[model samples]
Target: MGDSVTSRALALLGAFDGENRSLCLTELARRAGIPLATAHRLVGELHRWGALAREPGGDYVIGRRIWQLGLLAPVQSGLTQAASPFLHDLYGTTLATVHLAVRDGLEVLYVERLAGHVSVPVVSRVGSRLPMHATGVGKVLLAYAPEEVRLEVLQNLTRITAYTVTQPARLLDQLRRVRAEGYATTGEEMSLGACSVAVPVRNGETVVAALGMVVPDLRRQLPRLVSALQVAAHGISRTLAGPASVEWK
Candidate 1:
């Protein structure tokens, strides 16, 4: 099948990932599946427009302009801005690591986080992508995700830890529970010694994001953590539904 110039250009940019952040021209061409001449010409254009930059060692890296442009995306900008206060309040209240995330394709895309002074160590960061079946936020998002997205994720489940749920049927059951209970919880699913609880943040009838907290253990603070997260999620949903408002009270 023939790809359009736009699709090829996008493929070139999309070839780069968290692990493949930098590539030389030939490597970029091969990875992008574009002819070397076409890649060279298109990459030159992208470099000139600041979508990509040439490193001192001649590798191509994503440019600062791309990051600046990504920050302008409504999901990144408006949602992060609206959710900041609630995340801060949650962090202050529990001193647990608070996370805000949205579904990006079949993955949970971390958009914002507020770390507590003495919270448990977490591996996720803003802009990082985690599996949709292995995290509290991921479960919430998957519970409400489109059927095709859920199926795709179900087929490609990767176990990050021994506690991570890899069975499709089990994950589907958990997703149903997440929807029914209005929250999701995971114990050492994504990382050791880190447990998380998450609730959905809605924009009217649409579940636009997830609000979560990571703690060392859920044995003692599970109830309180869920309560606080639900409250913050409600506030965030209200803000997302109406005009921009930071009053998360």
Candidate 2:
């Protein structure tokens, strides 16, 4: 069906990226491949529906309404309900950035995060999205992700760093290793000077999310970090039925 969709509608929501937090209508339409008239109509609809906000200079930005909806999502409310106290305790006790994420489409979406006062900074926030090949949570999520998801992600791999795993066969083997080892570790794949450890949180046989911790000094902190992360993940798994029901395939 050839729907009469306007580029403006696409542009209004397409402006958000890791680098660009907000943008003007002109910028949006240009980026979305839409005309000015179409952009106006779609932008108006988005504003009325609270999907976009109008700034003082006539620019449109992602609205808080979207964030509010995310708050209601079970991954945020339900999962966080079980993960927050543990995350807080972990961060408080170890001075690290602790995070929980789930595989959403081909990316890992941060559902919850807790941080110590003085820890290594991370790019992820409660709604931030990251690729499955470059971060600790990403690796864990990808490892347990559905077969179709795994294939699709492997087909479109974008090597973000020298440490980023780009070979499909290799990644597949690593996923197997993660499953067997019950945890994952990455050294500066997402960013230099940062290393992370992650473990799966299961609901029956299906992995619904992953828990991770970031440490700046990978060489020295890894042993203790991996142990702490494994403990936290096991704690989460026990509460949520020990293993997930969704098969890897």
Per-residue lDDT tens digits for candidate 2, residues 93-185, read 778888999988999999888876666758788778999888888989998888898999999778877888888888888889998988787
C-alpha lDDT values of all predictions: 0.90, 0.79
lDDT of 1 at 84: 82
lDDT of 1 by residue, 144-173 (tens): 999999999999888899999999999999
List the candidates' TM-scores in order.
0.84, 0.79
> Model 1, 234: alpha-carbon shift in Å?
1.5
Counting clashing residue pairs in each candidate, in order, gives 0, 8
lDDT of 1 at 164: 92
- The weakest ten consecutive residues by lDDT in model 2 span 240-249
